[model samples]
Target: MMRIRHDQRSNEIPTPAVSFQPESVQMAVMKEKLTDQEAVVAIGQQDVRVRFVDGVPSDRSFMVRLVKQEGGTWVAQAVPLSSIGRFVPASLDDGIDLWLSARGIRLTEKEKEAVRRFWETEGGSIKQKQETVAALTAKQLEVTETHLRLAHEALHGPPLGDLLAPLLTKTEEPEETDEAKGVPVREQTERWEGSRAYAAASELVLPPAETRTFVMTAVTEKMRQLVHDFRVWQRDMARQLEQFSHAVAQQATERATPLVESLIHSLDRMLLNGDWLLFTDMKTETKLLEAGAKLAEAKRGLAEGKMDEAAKTVREVKALLESLRFQPSEQKVMRFFLESDERQGMKPHEQLSRILKQASQAARDNALSARGVVESLRRLGFFHEQEAARALLSGERLPPAENVKAMLLSWVEEGTAPAQAERVLMNLTGQQLLNKFTADSHTQTMLYQWPLSLHGEMATVHVHVNARSGNGQLDWQNCRLYFLLDTNQGKVGISLQAIERQLSVTVETESEKLAAVLQSYASTVKDHLEQIGYRVQRLVFQPMDTEDEERAATDRIKTENETSQWEWTI
Candidate 1:
């Protein structure tokens, strides 16, 4: 293998100065963070040019200008010889081979043998250890950056000055109360539900499914804390603004005024979304709107330096925020559950079936038994264990199933729950909820017999549908169909007596050729049927025919021969 060597450096490759310049200097400055014309020129100049000899570079060179490190050290990066202009390869493949050989990546015969042995022994563990090291390095870098940012903040002050400037400039104008900033409420809810559903259907279904509930509960509590914290913080800010210097007071006022207005504005927007209305009543929404108007008035007063009026308005806003509560909507939650992309082009029944299948697989993966499944549903407050069991056995809907689904979706939005209705659903297996709540259930087997005309002959095909195992392990052998050839293909005597004799006894044949023909036919038929959902379960072949009389005589002769042989030997 050929190796590239630079005379100025040790065994380690020197670090190269990295710069991005996709096009002209002006374009680079605008898009690639090239600060000035000098920077662009520095990056574009090919100060170091490399030439390849045999398979390796004779001298370490680059297409761009190389910037040296503090001690006049430079970084080296592998560049394709094709881009260097001086080195031309025979062909693309030859160039690739040369590149690999130059990098010592292409092994020698002895090295290849050694590698093969290593792979046969410890390749997997070595590869795994390398990945672990890489992951740790990346994590370390991330933590280091976070610590650096924190240190910078502690040394200086918070970066609030930059963030508050734009808002503070518009302090004179009344802030716009209600406009959608992020995703639409409906879309956000859909995305949240879709993510939850996707997680439940993934390889680790039970954990994600259970985790969704836990996360939602945590979010609700967190949001509650946020609202409380913000209100208290605003109250303190309002009090300080009246007593502090104008600069400090002005900044505090700017921050507090917008925060209150934003809180009220977001509340109004959420109320506008019908999903939010499921948890909040019309009376509550109307009250919230009134609070928002008061908050706006307070903001105006604060801006105008009317401290008393602003204080009075802040108190009103705080009271309204306290009065506001969240509750989950049943219909909206159900809709979220039912939502799916039409591009999959599945029927409603099919989609429901798929969801149930995923749930069952999730349960099995989580090591949940039938009784455990029932208990999970009861724990989720979907229904009592007895009720869930009965509902599953009878394929009936549980009474509290809607509420259970609604509670499951409480995490979709902060204000999507009623305190009483949104209870923590612990250890609720997704499969159990699907099995206990849904009316349609998974069937173990389905047999369908149909007559088909094949090769100018009529035959009956029996299709057996074997439901997959709870964990989604498909027993392909058990899920098949059997084709029974009609006995009327070859004609017997046309007389009534002959026909009666033919029909009286079962026709059995000892033919290897027939079995081969039937096997081919079964495969062809199975493939075609499966395209339209009728999958073959198993093929049951008939027993081979034999001559019992001949076999019995042969057995007696063999026994006599064996006895004579034994006597002679003795």
Candidate 2:
């Protein structure tokens, strides 16, 4: 007889007690039955104990594995039939390939083999796999969110096309004539005027007179608010200046007296007819800020008992106040602000390249810390560099692509310029979508949409880089780079491909004048490439229409694939 113990806590059967039988009887039974005889077993959800007797069949039975315990007794424990199969480790490499493919990224056979070996070398634990999946999902979600936000903005905000329509070249419309309209010229003109009036009237339920009155009221209220704010700011500044002048030396106070009198004069004029409000241009604001800074400097100098220094700063402040009094016309200021010409005569890429070169030299010379590097790059207007530095400082070992996106998100949280941040966010979304559609695992591709200030205008340059790697390392010699931007001249597309240090370049533009200009600089471009250890094999200018741009890109990619051993699809 054998006794079975049930676990009180779990209501699960414990290991069956060892059954002792005579050796001769066991041998005889084993000889008669080549395999172990299965015994009927029934287990309820709450019950755990199993009873064994001489041959009573049941629906379910436990497959027991017998092992000899201490002395001569044998122990029986239930073994699962499912666990008897040959063990095969989970294939994380396969999972990764499937995931990439699902996101529209195709891997070459060689790339697949490399990835498989990489996975084998760097074992993928369950935790690692989970983290990888989570990270990718989060990136996808972020891209989706960016796209949704952009869509919302496009739907709700003023149409960008409408804003740009005036700048774009317009086709001449055929002049309308009375003859064409089958009416007399005077009557035709009257009918057109009446139709315009009718259309205008149809737009609003209120009459034209009422609409005009409403607009006038709104304008008056807005002007009143602006005047009030200006008066408050002027009063506060004047009070502060008075206090500062009192705390300074006699010479400083004498110089500050003119500034205080000027502010009081402006306030008095504003009180009379609000004529002083008309002079509130950006230049005036700048001068006022400079005077405030000078006042602070004078105060600091007075605190330190430097009478001469305080007087000098006060004199500078007086000069700034004089300049503010002779401020330029509002029209001139508006024209200056509207000017969008490229003063430096350099493309966005050229400007970026120059800035990067300078930043690199500066970083090396200064031996800048990560945060210092970030600030320096930001000051130099290199957005990518700033984000990269921030990523390194974040202490997360993220890939370059992910690092950029992560830092962009952090910048949003840190309250960076909304326009700049949103531009980057949209750029990232575009890049991800592009990658998804045109992915090549053999050649790593990165897309960057860099916003550059070409003089006064903000120009976005789309940079696409494709680098081929055979041994899981970047091959700079086997790479392609494309830069695309819309300039005042036209849409410009520049493609540079390097195959074993032999470079081929193509500059395409819609404008013939721009094409000619680029062609003239072909030799200079070739020389520059050759100086950088690349033998310039080809340099050509091609005229491409805006409509054919996408087709040209596709054809170029196809041609590249045919010529190169490694596929270059970005």
Residue-level lDDT tens digits of model 1 in 1-570: 999877765756655754432211110111121222212122222232211122222233323212233232223233443443344444433333333344335435553343334334432343232222222222222222222222222112222112112211111312323431221333322323222322222222122445545544543453344345445644554443333323324557666665655554555444433333332223444565565556556666777877667777667666655655443332233223323221134543333233333222223322233232333333333444556587789988754432233334543355644332222222122112212211232323222222232342323322223333332332222232222233343211100001101111111123434544444565554454333223334333333223322322111111111121111110
Error of 2 at 455 (Å): 4.2
Model 2: lDDT to the true structure: 0.43
lDDT for every model? 0.34, 0.43
For model 1, the stretches where C-alpha displacement exceeds 4 angstroms are 1-279, 334-570
**Cα misplacement distance, residue 562 of candidate 1 (Å):** 99
Residue-pair clashes, model 2: 0
Where does candidate 2 stray beyond 4 Å?
Answer: 1-423, 426-440, 470-473, 551-570
Worst 10 residues of 2 by lDDT: 22-31
